[model samples]
Target: MRGVVLHAPGDVRVDHREDPTIIEPTDALLHVSATCVCGSDLWPYRGIETVDGPSPMGHEYVGVVEAVGDEVTTISPGQFVVGSFFASDNCCANCRAGYQSACRHRVPMGSLGTQAEWVRVPLADGTLVPTPRVPPDDLVPSLLAASDVLGTGWFGALAAHAGPGRTVVVVGDGAVGLLAVLAARQLGAERIVAMSRHEPRQRLATEFGATDIVTERGDEGVARIRELTDGLGAHSVVEAVGTQESMMQAIRSTRPGGHVGYVGVAHGVTLPGEELFYSHVHLHGGPAPVRRFLPQLIDLILDRVIDPGRVFDLTLPLDEAAEGYRAMDERRAIKALLVP
Candidate 1:
């Protein structure tokens, strides 16, 4: 098998690797069909996180089952499946409470490297959701989105309580943020304001259901959001960037009692306790429990209610994984999908 590995900061390579096998009675080996680079991958690719040696990269994936361990009865060989980025034992307390990402026996998808010809999925019954069948080629990207960005965007919308008659403002213009706008609209948000300056992202935001686009930064961003909302800030705000600036923009753009749902992989961030205390904004974020929403999202994708896969503006062969990373890092592409 061949997979993508991050040898060190700025060094990503595709090399031959041993194929994964069923390691646990509950595990399953998947023949990876599609995978994509995530914004989070940029953290290490740009040297923000220390990369000691070659580490498996990527979490988003959609594939077919090649083999299943003894205890896996729900899925079987030849079945196509979509999995959450985080593997979980669906029977756990947190999972039962709809927090699968924090399941007592949760595992990250990166540990097995989905950016490969094949990989093993832990907790098969809990982690993998079998689709109705192998989908058409165009639907592959939407299935892949279920593993990360779309799910995260849905989580952000849910956290912010986006719904009927609410005005929602989205912070950041990355795949997740753009999808957040789409999710809000799908949830019946009356007004969706997207704060972005990038032309490509702005266009995508509108296509995805943004009612208005605000090209401003910092205080100016907040002011535009407020002005659009009749002097009050948005009823809900989704923060899809992990940086302090983006966080502040989310908080400032939301009403005092509004919720700020942040889903960006947080980096170099600390909030002043006093500020939050007086702001009265509800802040909720962490690794999104995408497993909890997989079933519904898959249904939506299959039904064509949403086309979240439109985020992948660039596609490359598996061998060209390094170039995909470079394009994203250079902001030449919003996201890159890799096919094996």
Candidate 2:
């Protein structure tokens, strides 16, 4: 099998690798049908996140089950499935409380490398969600999106408490951020503000239900959000970028009593205790519990009520995985889909 390996910053490659096989009775093997580069993948590619060695890359995936361990009964071979980056038992206390990402037996899937012909999924019954049937070729992308970005975006909206009669602001314009805008709209936010300077992203934001676009950065960006909210700031703010500046912008753009839901992978961020103490804004975010929302999101996509797949502006064969990384790092593509 061939898979993506990050040798160093700006040095991603597609190379031959040993094929995956079931190692645990609770595991399942999947023949990956579609996978994609994630915004978070750039962290290692750009050296923002250090890599000690040539490590396997990619997490978001949608595939057909090729085999399953004896313990895996809920899912079977030949079923199409979508799952989160973190594999969970789904029966843990945290999972029961709707936080599968933090399940007691959680296993990070990036190390398993889904951007390949096949990969092993641990705790298969709890981690993988089978689609009603094999989705059509056209619906594959949307189902792939639900594997990560769409579910993460939905978690962002839920964390921010987006709902009818509330003004919501999204602080990033990446795929997840754009999907967050969509999630906010579906959650019934009366107004959705998307902060982005790129014309392409701004256009997509509007198409995804953004009522306003703010191009400013830092303090100016917060001011624009407040101005549009009649000087009270937005009722809820979704921080999709995990940088210090984006986090501050999200915090500052929400009203004192409002909520700030941050989903960006924080790199070198530090929130001053005093500032947060007086800000009075509620903060909630981490690895999104994507499994918690997979069932509902899958239903929405299958019903054609939403089109989150539109976020993928570029597509490439799995062998051209390096180009996929470059396109995203250069901002030439919002998201890149990889077919194996």
Candidate 3:
């Protein structure tokens, strides 16, 4: 098998790697049909996140099950499936409480790498969700999106309490952020504001249901949200960039009783305890428990209710995974889909 390996920052390569096999009775092996380079992958690629020697890359994946261990029941060989970054035992306490990302037996799939021809998924019954049948070619990307970004965006909207009559603001214009707009719309938010300077992203945001676009950042970004909301700020704000500036802007852009759902992987972010205590804003977010919403998100995609796959502006063959990373890092692509 071949997969992506990050030898160091700025040095990602597609190299021959050992094929994955079932090591646990609950595990399953999958023939990866589609995979992607996520915004989070940029962290280590840019050196902001440390790269300690060689490391496997990629997490979002949609595939066909080739084999399953004895313990795997719900998912079977030859079924098309979607799985997120975390392999969790969905029967755990946290999973039962709708936080499968924090399941007691969760495993981060990135360490195993999905940017390969084959992938080994653990806790198969709980981690993999099968589609009703093998979807057509056009629906593959959308199903792939459901593996991560779409699910994360759905979690973001739900956490922010987006609903009928609510005014929602989304910070960041990446795939997740743009899809947050889509998610907010699906959740019935009355108004959706997308903060983005990039024209392509702005256009996609609008197409995804954004009622307005704010291009400013930092304090100016917060001011724009206020101006649009009649100085009261939005009823809910979704932060998709993991930066101190983006985080603060999100908090300041929400009204006193509004909610902020931050899904960005925070990098060196810190908050002033006193300011937070006085803000009267509610904050809730972390690694999105994508598995929790995979089933519903899959149905939405299959029903043609949402076209989240439109976020993938670039597609490349599996061997060109490095170029996919480069395009995403250079902002030349909204999201890159790699075909294995």
Task: Provide the overall lDDT of each model, using Cα atoms, as 2-decimal numbers.
Answer: 0.92, 0.94, 0.94
**Cα error, candidate 1, residue 68 (Å):** 0.4
Q: Residue 250 of model 3: what lDDT?
A: 94
Clashing pairs in 3: none
- Looking at model 1, the pairs that clash are none
Tens-place lDDT digits, model 2, residues 1-340? 9999999999999989998999999999999999999999999999989988999999999999999999998999999999999999999899999999999999999988888889899999999999989999999999999988998888999899999999999999999999999999999999999999999999999999999999999999998987898898999999999999999999989999999999999989999999998889999999999999999999999999999999999999999999999999999999999998
Where in model 1 is the C-alpha error above 4 Å?
A: none
The TM-score of candidate 3 is 0.99
What's model 2's overall lDDT? 0.94
What candidate 3 gets wrong by more than 4 Å, as runs, is none
Cα RMSD (angstroms) for every candidate in the order listed = 0.9, 0.6, 0.6
Candidate 2 least-lDDT 10 residues: 223-232
Task: Quote the positional error of residue 191 for candidate 3 in Å.
Answer: 0.5
Rank by lDDT, descending? 2, 3, 1
